[model samples]
Target: MAEQGKAAEGRIRIGIGGWTFPPWRGRFYPAGLAQAKELAYAAGQLTAIEINGTYYGSQKPESFQRWHDETPDGFVFTLKGPRFTTNRRVLAEAGPSIERFVTGGITRLGAKLGPINWQFMPTKSFEPEDFAAFLSLLPRDCDGITLRHAVEVRHPSFACPEFVALARRHGVAVITAGDSPYPQIADPTAPFAYLRIMGTTEMAGGYDAAAIARWAARARDLAEGRVPEDLACAGVPQPPGPPRDVFLFVIGGFKEANPAAARALIAACA
Candidate 1:
């Protein structure tokens, strides 16, 4: 990892998957808050968000710009790479589709755009050559701005040294999926780290205070480039690398408890 401007203070951001959950209207969100104000409100609470809608379809430039304008400075939105490409049968032939998605209006988000997550299905087993070809299609920059990439491979076959080497070669982060049915990877291959917390309680707040504290410690370790021994990672053990920025998100454990989970994580980290 290269030196970053925010590394000194530990650039760790905690957030939820998305902000438009109707269940949160009266639970996590204010009772009378307008639906349109949800993004703005959520942005004020969390440091970053994972944009899942983009995986379904392309969004307009205007929508991207509006999201940027609504958020506070330094807030970021990590987009899900369109399923059209990832779900295709031949992963190697997804270049054009990848181009269209990359050159789309996503650049309108400018500095607010974070990592692009290319999530593979649980059945998508590790195919070194094919997966490497797909990774080759990812652009380090969109237009003139730099972009980061992460791959969320669910199949257990991905938990191998070869997969780790491929990702490290491409400088793409392998998502650290916390408590999921999917394989958890803590390689920290990219310049930064991206995490998805899949297990949260159905309680009012997503996680209990103890869990929140544990996650906070994990976040601190990530920012400081210290990978915990407990987490699973592919390949042989390696020494701790330099500190880098970290982006953490709570992805659908208890849907309504997401906001509270994010807030609690943020407070614990602070």
Candidate 2:
């Protein structure tokens, strides 16, 4: 494992995926990014975060600067590429938009950023070949920032060995979620695994018992790998080496027990 940063580098790291409570925009987030930092501070025990709201558009400089200033050092942040970067838009339509959004987000995130997720919208006919081509088209230099990249394939056509091969080939981490179809394609060898466990139906309705156990186990394995470093590649040598500190995010649980669930998972993970 790499020499760790400040926060405790567990075998695996954990946090709530996000808090998209609609109320934030009107009250907590009158501006946007600055408010998110404050919200992050309030999440209690979270050491890292993955921001989804930014997927809608690029953030303003002032907003991002607030993020840079407010977050405790060693806070890892993962952000999904904006809609313009990954929607069903034609290549012609997507090209420019991708450039703009990626450039903006990278600049905004700067050093705080970790992974950039490209979550595909599931469609019946989205085959592997076409998807492979799409993956190829992504600019290696997104916003001049070469952060860890990941992709989540929701279409049923993506659940196959070939797709996983393509992901590894492109250095794109295949996201592991509690969602249907996508979960079927989980890759254990990914550089950093991410779990978006939630209550959504697309995630098989609610959390499954076995799925939670899988998450707990993964947390243990990854935390063991961290060894107290922010980035986990210091002396990691080669394949089948210790797992990097993955993010096992509880995106959902019973609404009432959300906090309790996070704590329980954290304890089990410890």
Candidate 3:
């Protein structure tokens, strides 16, 4: 009952990119904690963790099942789609790779499967026809579970109306990444929101109270189906809709401090 109530106010999940950070071993995890218990420990601290390992390679069903058993209920994992699918030069040829990833042991996680983040190289720019063909390959349902997709296009060329319209037409969220060398486009192109905050410094507690408060407001705005105008890279008009779910990940920069940053944002959301 308590968990349901908390989820009802807004399904804003705050987390870091991955859990297997060496820096977190002593700072976040207790001293002498078993290395294998990292995910469980981290899941207890944050609402979700982006599965970055999968971006590099695939995992077995047992691995996914174990991850499902480790996390608490309502916890989710925003998986990075395999680079084999998103890193290809000819985007149209990525169909088989996409199928392999989608049909991989991912569905073994069941409801714990959150969003599949299809991150492209910073050099990859928008090619309407090619991009649309790739988006078409994304499965609406993997096995029997519904799937959610988010595209993390790093190039500045993606910050355009045409790109936003294409993503919206396909109901795929255009990732609103935080401080980066690439464009941090913050357009809500889908029913859900995905953010990768890469600006955390080594400041005390990762982010000061003020910064977390501001981010909390932004997460709240996204959950309410509104865009935070100040943070948006493109000036697209807000799409009309009811409130939506949100996934916020603290990643990059002072990577060691990401866990603290995630906890701070989660507290601010409370």
Candidate 4:
């Protein structure tokens, strides 16, 4: 997939939400392809994948190890944080669940582990103190491996300067969710940037050529630590810093065409 590695400015990884889909059997996957070989085949086509299964329940250590062994080098997987940890009344009390998730054999992924996405419910509003406490519960490292965390806040209350400041203080990224009802916070809060774009089904490749070109340019701007002027920012503009790694995933809308959209973005980035 266009030589998965650091670009001229910074590393850019493009992928889809998950690898397993029934519709993809004959469309994305070849006809009569074995189910066991799906991950391997998908990994060969994309640089990264966001694992949504981890959000539902805890997985066995062997499962994580097997996934690691199946994928090739330079491939990475981003896990969705368990719902029990994020879907709570008092976020501060989620420490125990958070601890369980972080220590639940995730380190088995080794170098293949990307960021852990802690997605909050749309009904959850931004309580500065409680949100800060929730961020504090996230560990910086686990089993000698440095961990990266990203929060996907769907509520409109998160579109504020205070929220951005809080995230920046903890060095946790705020996911840029595109083409969804969720508020799109494009501020750069962490060392790396995370984006999830949902392209329309009307277009053959999820998005038109011009739209893909615009997203590719935005991805490059994020990688080089320069916020794109076209995107909305809640906080005051900051000076450009060093290059940062970027993770972009094509999700939702026109699910079957997501892989093609990701591949197109990868080629554009190259």
> Per-residue error at 218 for model 2, in Å?
2.1
By TM-score: ranked, best first: 4, 1, 3, 2
TM-score for each of the candidates: 0.96, 0.71, 0.95, 0.97
lDDT of each: 0.87, 0.57, 0.86, 0.91
Candidate 4 lDDT, 151-201, residue by residue in tens: 999999999999999999999999998877889999999999999998658
Candidate 4 residue-wise lDDT at 194: 95
Best prediction by lDDT: 4
Residue 176 displacement in candidate 3 (angstroms) = 0.3
Model 2, 228: alpha-carbon shift in Å? 22
Clashing pairs in 1: none
Q: Please give the ranking of all candidate structures by lDDT, highest first, separated by commas.
A: 4, 1, 3, 2
Residues 1-270 of candidate 1: C-alpha lDDT, one tens digit per residue: 121124354588888887888888889789999999999988887889999999999988889999999998889899999999899778999999889988889998998899999988889999888999999988889789898999999999999999998999999999999978888889878889999997887888878998888888888887887887678888767788888788999997887888898888888877
In candidate 4, which residue ranges exceed 4 Å CA deviation?
A: 2-8
Residue 225 lDDT, candidate 1, scale 0-100: 79
Worst 10 residues of 1 by lDDT: 1-10
